[model samples]
Target chain A: MTDRDTTPAIEFRGVVKRFGDNTVLDGLDFTVAKGDRVTLIGPSGSGKTTILRLLMTLEESNGGLILIDGEPYTHEMRGGKRVAVPEKRRRQVRRRVGMVFQQFNLFPNMSVLENIIEAPVHVLGLSTAQAVVRAEELLEQVGLADKRDARCTQLSGGQQQRVAIARALAMDPEILLLDEVTSALDPEIVADVLGVLREVAETTDITMLIVTHEMQFARDVSNRVLMFDHGRIIEEAEPEVIFTAPREERTQQFLSAVLGEDTADRS
Target chain B: MSDNLQTLGDALPRLGDAVLVTLQLTLGGAALAFVLALLLGFGSRSHRGAVRVPSRVVVEFFRGTSLIVQMFWLFYVLPVFGFRLESLACGVLALGLNYGAYGAEVVRGSINSVPAGQWEASTALNLGHVHRLRRVIFPQAWALMIPMFTNLLIQLLKGSALATYILLHDLNYFTEQLRRSTQDTFFSFTFGLLVYFAIAYLLTLVMNALEVRAKNRLGAGPTLREVLRIAPVPATAKAGAA
Candidate 1:
């Protein structure tokens, strides 16, 4: 690798995350280049969502240095030892990232527009009018313009997820994390959420780290695909290459199992 | 019967004055308790021992002790320790501290009931702790707290009747006076019971309205106007009228 001034969008070096007795992520190392779209595919409890949560600063890794835009967000070396970053600095780093959850966790107390504009108006210090205009545009992009005034609980799962997408986008984040954004939707509405995401992937250069079960969406939206198993990345390749000709035995086995289930469901 | 009626009529003005004092204590105590409940509730959830321990101690102390004893202590014992309070003040303070402790649990439980995902979403937005609680968590929690708070409020109102023991001359005091003077214990107690019931019922209506409003904000319940709207007459009723 040549020395370059430009920073990778995200870098996790020897990241270790554990929950009680369960070790979720062990000695994980990876780099996502600026503007790259990466998809993580793995079985349940394989730590795919943990990666997104850590990036969003919703969960702190037990041991690791997570770098956002080449600046350490979680910990930094001081006096030859890793020291936790101050909360003030951690918050500043987190501002560059946003996440949409599987549950479509839009604020139920807020309307769709309020949910979208909340962070922008409050955290980003944008004027309400400015945030509202931006929110309306994002709502229109997500095909939810008419539902802007509706309270989030009044929306269907797909609509709520779309609003969540728009809410993340409203922050104008440099990196976006999607953790099974469509998994909660009914099958008929899954496509609608994915369609909005597809548009986002196509039109924007926002770096994306996604954990999704939608194989077709993964193939369409991600430039790179990572296959995880038991807290380790078993394989990494282009989406097409990974889908068509995975080299690792574990990756091939996992793909066949998942695809078999998909085919069985369809048939 | 006429003499009893005349005696009751004569006592009405004094009873009315006492009723006003009772209302003041109930409303004041509830307001103070609400503020204390929110403080202790949030404090109990604090990440630091300094805040959480004290809050726990206060909540347990009030909850474990009897409210009547607390009232007597505040009114009678405090004066011996160079701290004097008026009877009304003592009654309100005792009610506030005692019930506030119970209300704190309601606040804590309701706040915890807000889904974990909501907290994660707020954190993902990079909202600071205060903003997260004020904007995202508390509003949803408020809706959950109202039904429980309504229960606490009614309990607090009934508890205010204990004020009579402290010489506050609230509704119960006048009822006792009426009983002794008229020599009609049954009617005096019944009248006091009816007044308390009426106040509690009114409070229920007010709290129900508040609950409806809060749930309406969450898109869960019908608005008060929608609930109150008269249903259109059936075609059968129209035919019968014709």
Candidate 2:
């Protein structure tokens, strides 16, 4: 912990997100050091996915500021006041971040190779030939090289998700957000999908903010785990500390419910 | 006395001219309507109030008013402002504006029918607004809109009958003349009905073919070759493969 550099890779300051009358994230503040894999664990509507959505700019924050690499990402300063930044600013931040959704939202309009290369070719201004070569490499990395010409709809759930991962990786993003990437998979194929992600976590230096219910996968990949409840961080620590010696009563209950175990050894 | 006889020969040529006029109005109005529908449809979804509000107003105004009255206004009243258009032009304008308002709904709804997840995915990919619509969204939506657009095409074809009221000398006009010369109302109108139905049927086929092409692009439904029966049902496909 002492060796951790002072510069933060991602930071939030009193960020608030709301939907209609509900406050999903209320005055949330946190920081992630560079190259940390943090998994957010909680019950449904506990603002775990909301945190990822806010970073991806899929949902606009009602208040506060999010800084990426220690610079303004969501809200900008205008006249000494924090204001919701314009879409242009948010889009610039979004370029460096990639997300894989729970539902494998691959473009049914394109082949597997086309889906991977589309953003790179159109958004990043990469040459078609260059993007295709890189996309093939990513497909190989995700273990889907043979499904290159297959349409997204033709693939099984795990294959589609793997393609989605390949699609996100082709852009070469600095921050990769995984939102229940395997939550929609069948139990049999879930392992196959997670295996790819495990490899990604092991091989890549990309900063990750993952939200998943699979505690074991979280433990295997993440250095830190943040337990959330009702839009606030109830507790956060290394997986070993949180799993084996959860200090908070709420953390213990949640771990028991998700783990389906009675282990509260330090209760 | 011979005028009363009015051989089918003389009347057929005049009817040909009238059929051409009706087609001109139907196709011309259809072209204009499609353009206006696209404009108002995309504009109605604009984030700015100025564009959206006025687009709604235009859609409602054209949809609420009578097509005949709008044609009359363009042809009859515009002269008061010293801007008279040709009668055919007036008919086309009125038909386009009225039907385009309806088509705009088809466009908006079909675009929305594409799943929200697709939009979210495109956003995550950091696609620009136009590229998102062009490269991703509209291709899906275009397939959805074509079926509904087909319905509008038929309606516009029928609505072109209102053109006769503007003295456009269309099929409806010639049919009326046929009744007076032949002095038989039933035959004249029945003939007109059959021709319009034929044209409408042709338009439907054209639209259905377009829909098949679109669906084939998405790999959703049967191929155009299957639907059109051009490939003889792949019973031979196995032989060729072997």
Candidate 3:
């Protein structure tokens, strides 16, 4: 494909997810171009993480489709009919995607270095030497080079999270999904992890879809910000426009509550 | 009294043979139980009711029945229906089936204890079901399953002693013979009990040591060899310039 004709790295079209009677994603639609940085902001239960998870194919969408590199991820159109692709095909699609979890879901049984190299060595079929070389380099990038040999359980929350980011990057994915990655860390450590992410956003060409509560970080890092509430993107705009002059009433209330915390801390 | 004591004492050599027989039965039965349980546990993961319901039924049926009754059924009733198995084979089969059912639940629960994220993570890496299990899921499950499987093993060992009823000449059988000839119920039965206890305790100790070693190996970081193996090649300007 020509560079100009390259598809957006990720696209979600009218995606809907429901758990029993509760609908978490209500016909959500969005797109992120190659190498773009986007952040999703929302209150709890607003389906920000669900959107990331659906893109990762961790959870299947109940309706509509998620596309990766302009190809459907969860299903395929066979003879003009949407048919569920086999899990093997879905897995191949998933390899192009990577995610960092809010809980820092590093494999508890593996060391930090092993966690970083596991997908590369096993999934990507890279040589162990090559994978490890790449792993240590990414570890250096995340500022956790010294912690490579450490057990996952031994690292502090922030250190583990940094390692997790390195692990996701080791796969060299086209898209990286961060689901409130710093939300589970101590307040002091949150800055350290966010700093690493900010550095990644500056340095890497990978597209990022971040679900975050840190409004200031979202405003600074995001090219575009979408405000979600009860699933749909109620407001979407450039970060400057969304932060300074959101047109929607719901956006104003949400931003005010988040910004009020900063005012309290300063005063 | 002295003659009776001598008679009981002479049978001690035969008890060794019987003890060996018991060990063979127990180990064989336990090995079969482990494999069957793993299969059963994975089979239970099927989403369809047709597959899941029948597996659950089979697991519960074997688990609910007493080992003794099953042993008798295999030895007697199975032969009547033209399934003639040797007594030792019948004993091993019954023991495996009975304990296999119990072991299946342990396997199922241990596999389930693996976080949902691990599955998602494996899927993200493009590892299929067999590879997902062998490389990622089973190693972790193996760690958790060892302790419960050890407990099951002890039960299986105890169950092996029951084979004397089917005339397998295991430890209990020799003990019974010694008791009948010498009428030394106290010494004979007590000796038999002590042997059983000793075997059980030793097996548990070995299993515990294995559990510790497995956990250490799993938790152990890269070995020195692995670390060295991973060290990088220096970038050579001479080759690049050439």
- The best candidate by TM-score is 1
Residues A91-155, model 1: lDDT tens digits: 99999998999998889889889998999999999999999999999999999999888877767
Stretches of candidate 2 above 4 Å error?
Answer: A1-5, A261-267, B1-9, B230-242
Ranking by DockQ: 1, 2, 3
The candidate 2 chain A region of ten consecutive residues with least summed lDDT is A258-267
Give per-residue CA lDDT, model 3, range A65-145, as digits (tens): 788888788976688876777777787888888889888877767788888888898889999999999999999998989
Model 3 interface Cα RMSD in Å: 11.0
Total residue pair clashes for candidate 1: 0
**Global Cα lDDT for candidate 1:** 0.90
- The top-ranked prediction according to DockQ is 1
Docking category of candidate 3: incorrect
- Give the clashing residue pairs of candidate 1, or none: none
Clash totals for all models, in order? 0, 0, 0
- Candidate 2, residues A203-257, lDDT tens digits: the string is 9998999998778889889999999999999999999999999999999999889
- After superposition, the stretches of candidate 1 with alpha carbons farther than 4 Å from their true spots are A1-5, A264-267, B230-242
Q: Write the per-residue lDDT of candidate 1 for residues B1-242, one digit (tens) a residue.
A: 67777998998899889989999999999998999999999999999999999999999999999999999999999999999999999999999999999999999999999999999999999999999999999999999999999999999999999999998889889889988988998888898899999999999999999998888787775666766674653343223111
Order of models, best lDDT first: 1, 2, 3
TM-score of chain A of 1: 0.96
Fnat computed for model 3: 0.31
User: Model 1, DockQ value?
Assistant: 0.47
| Candidate number of the best lDDT | 1
